[model samples]
Target: MISELIANAVVHGSAGLDEPIFLWFEGSSECLRIEVRDSSAEPPTVRPVEPEDESGRGLWLINELALTWGHGPRDDGPGKRVWVSIAPAHMGLL
Candidate 1:
């Protein structure tokens, strides 16, 4: 989930090679939350899949695997933070 979010930030966000990407992970025995921060104000959205499409399935995969997911403005600076939370039932696989 975290990897997908980071890839989305790199591919879709305005993150440059020199820019830093921040990752946050918070979890207990029950649930886990993952956040990826990049230097783009544009929010991430799930793109519609086409029948012959060879790519663009990251968000869709996240939607299927995560209990919940979303994005919002960065707290410290410009850009957006995309996040996902996994429910307790799925934590054991981590």
Candidate 2:
């Protein structure tokens, strides 16, 4: 899940190869939250997938696996932060 979020940020968020991407993780007994921040203001979106499509399935996977997910303007800069929350039920298997 984290890898997908970071890849999406790198590919869709206009981040340069050397640009910094920040990840923050927070967890409690019942939930875990992951945030990925990159240097683009453009938000991520889910596109309709064709059966033969070989790409563009990252967001779909996140939606299917995450308890909740979203993105917004970065609190620290000009980019955006994409985040996902994993419930306790989902974390146990990890």
Candidate 3:
């Protein structure tokens, strides 16, 4: 999940924005939290796709598959950061 979001942030989020993209990951016994910050004020929006569309399903899949996900302004920039958290499927697995 973290990898996917971060990749999306780098490929799509920062496109033409020339902004720094930062990734933070933290985990506890219960869950993992991942955040990706990019230099774009505009947030990532999940839009509808056509039937024959061959791409554009990254963030959409994340939103649908993640336990919870959101995007907001970064603390030190004009861009935004996207965050997602998912509960551990098994205790002490990692």
Worst ten in a row by lDDT for model 2: 85-94
CA error at residue 15 for candidate 1, angstroms = 3.7
Best candidate, TM-score: 2
For candidate 3, report its TM-score: 0.79
lDDT of 2 by residue, 1-94 (tens): 9999988888888567877899999999888999999999888898999999999999999998899999999989879999999996775665
Q: Model 2 off-target regions past 4 Å?
A: 90-94
Query: In model 3, which runs have C-alpha deviations exceeding 4 angstroms?
Result: 15-18, 90-94
Q: What ordering of candidates by TM-score runs from best to worst? A: 2, 1, 3
| Candidate 3 weakest ten by summed lDDT | 85-94
lDDT of 3 by residue, 1-94 (tens): 7777777787777846556788898888788888998877778888787878987777777777777889999898777889988775632345
Best by lDDT: 2
**Per-candidate clashes, comma-separated:** 0, 0, 0
Q: Compared with the true structure, what per-residue lDDT tens digits does model 1 show for residues 1-94?
A: 7778878888888567888889999998778899998999988878899989998889999988898899999998989899999986764564
TM-scores, one per candidate: 0.88, 0.90, 0.79
**Candidate 1 Cα errors over 4 Å, as ranges:** 90-94
lDDT of 2 at 60: 97
Give the Å error, residue 26, model 2: 0.5
